[model samples]
Target chain A: MNKRDIALIIIILIIAVLSYCIMNISSDKDGDMVLVTVDGKSYGTYKLHEDREFEIQNEYGYNIISIHDGEVCIKDADCPDKYCVKQGKISKNNESIICLPHKLVIETVRTMDDGGAGDIDSVAK
Target chain B: MSKHVAKLGIFIALAMIFSYIEVLIPFSFGIPGVKLGIANIVVVTGLYILKPQEVFVISVLRILLMGFLFGNMLTLVYSLAGGILSFVVMLVFKKITLFSIIGVSAAGGVFHNFGQILMAAFILHNEKIMYYFPVLLVAGVITGILIGFLSDNIIKALKHYN
Candidate 1:
């Protein structure tokens, strides 16, 4: 490997490390909401603090979601690989449990303490 | 020249075969959109061997044909985004002539992941999709290096044979 090759490798490594740090820091549990999307459509947004169990059904399959104690996870899924269920619990914004087979994505989103702030933050820039 | 067209066709076919091999192997790493991107070897090799326009044509045709044969509309979008972006980056690096084929290919791999994730974020309408960026970057580097080495060997073999 030449100097350019080594430099490129180093740059990529630095980017990887920086990105990992960014993802971890950004996922901090500042958000109290979870957004469920099915096939690119918004299903609903639920509170993370509230305890509840709900099932999302679509033509592909279904994913059962559970929320309790400020965390969310896939309680169960009919998809061939239970990867979503295995994704475990997520309590932070940007953390998502995705069921690729079902095209279902449950992502943690942060809403401001004032309900209206979420919209402004998300939409109004 | 007819020889040029024939060479491009062969490269496209090889790329398609590589994609099929990946599918047959079931190399799912559990994170959606993560794959070996092994077909990239063909693109890198083509970059080094063919004219710019010829390489572009081969890359676009490969994605379109592969999408039609083995994927759906969504797959078309993902592959187009990734393939085009990676091809562009590879071309730019090739022009700069600052790195080896392996370095250029590695950069192409990372850019490919970025483009795919960007399209996914848009389709899913979720900003949180950015979370996958880091993991994808890491995966990109690993796969890029693997494919780069493979492409380098293939290119060298072809040169020796020629």
Candidate 2:
């Protein structure tokens, strides 16, 4: 490795640090709702405190989502990778568990009345 | 020309073997889109021995064949995006001549992750996927450096063949 290679490594590390900090800071607020999207469309929005299980079956595949104690996770999935299930649970605003093979996304979102500024009003609209 | 074609075939086969080996290892970091990228060893080595276009072809062919044999359609899309993006970035860095093979490979590694994440965001229609970027970035650099180091030594040993 030469001087330029060292510099390149340093630059990449800096970018990683900056992005991590930004993502953490922006997601400081706890989410109050879980928004599920399938194939770029809204599947459903459930309150985080509800403690429920949601089953999603579609053309792509199947996934079972469970929300409990204000944290959301994919309890089960038929996708090959299972990365979403492995992602564990997310409680912070904007946190997500994505099933890429099924084109499914389960995101933690803050509702408008919950003091999350500038968020869309509802998934229904 | 025939000799070059024959060499390209060998490199492509080498890359595919690397891909197969990677699949056999069951390597996982729990996070999606993170891997050792073992196949990159061949592509990085090709940068010094073959034309940029030839290296690109080998990389593309490797992704396609691996996807068909072991992966699905969705994986094929993700691999194509990451493979193409990294190849372009590596070619540009190599042309600059300021960085060594390790640096070029490192850049390729980081861009490969970035490209895959970007594609994920687009397909999922949510920018929240960007949250995975930082972890993937670090993983990319580390794996890229390892692959680059291996490529550097391979290039050195192959110098005698010229």
Candidate 3:
């Protein structure tokens, strides 16, 4: 409605679009489980079968990570805010999920082959 | 003396009603503990209508009452952190930002989440949990927009309603 409004709108719109590109993203085939290795440890694994759900806990609380229909996500969490759980689902297009509180991320990448969307690696099952 | 008591009663009632609304809105994002926190609108209203100390008193009372009614003692920590942080953030925004009430309210939403998360990490002693910062920040961005957008429209309408 005014100049300030327009500026804020522009900033928000940019952020929204930039962020949209990161949602519903999936990873390449890493067998039945896509292991996101952060630092020296395996942060967690995404079980690629009919969109499974799991939880991983760090210092903060339990993070409910859900993978469904070939996508992965943080489904529920014990963290105070639960923002990661609220992020909805993510797929290959988005390719990764990150929760700041958990210092965790679930990303998609083929350890063997690159099949286009919907190609489920037999080993990844 | 009786009139003062009546005002307090009305304020408490309004807060309870708003808290109920906060729990009922259906915006589940498939993540645990995610909510729009709409009930905060009442606290924001208190901030504007009552003195800061009065607002503090009301906030403590509301959180305690709501916790007793619907939440556990553990959960009260997060609520208290969120409420107090929101007040601080809103107070700062009010001083410097030209944003409308909606914007101020949205900032409060983000602050509330931030405070809650900070407390969680502190209590748990897990600095790694801070990684959720970006994700929550993103959520805060979205929820802030949502609260701000709604409050903006409401603020515009409040003039005529009052």
Candidate 4:
């Protein structure tokens, strides 16, 4: 490892720390937990009544997301590209399900006063 | 009409096939953009089998086609950057490390993702984009290792078979 290599290493370390912090911070919860479901299977859970909850699913190599409730996950997906999954929960606020390879995403968001899913609505349009 | 031309054609086809096959399998990596990068194996193989110019051709075609078939056209720029960067890095690393095909392929894979992320950060111009670099790097490392390991065995098997 030369000086260049060393510099690259430091940069990567910083990125890892930053990525961890961002994911953790956004994954935070400050209200009642929401039971996010898809096709009746419990993929994951988040705390935020209707308006503030988010959930994702990795079903058979395809990722799906549920914004406020279980009503929506990625409409279409395959392993080819999960751009939609990466898109995350893009609400008008900043949430959406992205399927990267598939190039599909639901960039729709909802407002939250309590940051809970209790007020979340479903518009899988 | 020409032996070299036939070989180059064969390599291109093989790379495309590998890329398609890799696209089908689902990776367990929770993070997005993680995969075997199997098509990269062909790119590495081309470097070994053909001249540098031919290798470059294969690399560009592989990435461009993969994007066109599986990705949005808007992503073409990122794909081009990644493929070119990896090709260049592999060319340089070849002189320094002189490792086997697998080693070279590994290096190429890491370079590929690093280049892509770099382009993404540039286009987005959001410092926040920097946060994803580390995770992408780590994933790139693991994928590179896998691609390298597989290609190594392939060379070994082919050498003996021939």
Which candidate ranks first by DockQ, i.e. highest?
Answer: 2
lDDT of 1 by residue, A82-122 (tens): 77888899887667887756777887766665446664366
Per-residue error (Å), model 2, residue A106: 0.5
The reply for model 3, stretches above 4 Å from the true place, is A1-125, B1-5, B24-26, B149-162
Q: Provide interface RMSD per model, one decimal.
A: 2.2, 0.9, 6.7, 8.7
lDDT tens digits by residue: candidate 4, B26-138: 65587766666677887776676557888899889877877788766647788788889999988887767545555566567777888887776555432334445667777
* DockQ, 0 to 1 scale, candidate 4: 0.13
- Select the stronger candidate by DockQ from 1 and 2: 2
Better of 2 and 3 by lDDT: 2
Relative to the unseen true structure, what is the C-alpha lDDT of residue B64 in candidate 2, on a scale of 0 to 100?
Answer: 95
Measured with C-alpha atoms, the lDDT of residue B139 in candidate 1 is 82
TM-score for all predictions? Answer: 0.84, 0.95, 0.57, 0.61
DockQ of 2: 0.83
How would you encode candidate 2's per-residue C-alpha lDDT over B80-142 as one tens digit per residue?
Answer: 999999999999999989999989999999999999989888887877788889998999999
- Which window of 10 residues has the lowest lDDT sum in candidate 2 chain A? A116-125
Q: Name the candidate, 3 or 4, with the larger DockQ value.
A: 4
Which scores better on lDDT, 3 or 4? 3
Best by lDDT: 2
Tell me the alpha-carbon RMSD of every candidate. 3.3, 1.9, 8.0, 9.0
i-RMSD of model 1 (Å, 1 decimal) = 2.2
Clashes of 3: 33
Flag regions of model 4 displaced more than 4 Å. A1-82, A85-125, B98-102
Q: How many angstroms is residue B50 displaced in model 2 relative to the true structure, after the best TM-score fit?
A: 0.1
Task: Give the per-residue lDDT of model 1 (tens digit) for B1-162.
Answer: 897678777998998898889878857777666889788888888888788887888888889998898877777888899999999998998899998887888899899999988887777666666777888887887788888899889988999767
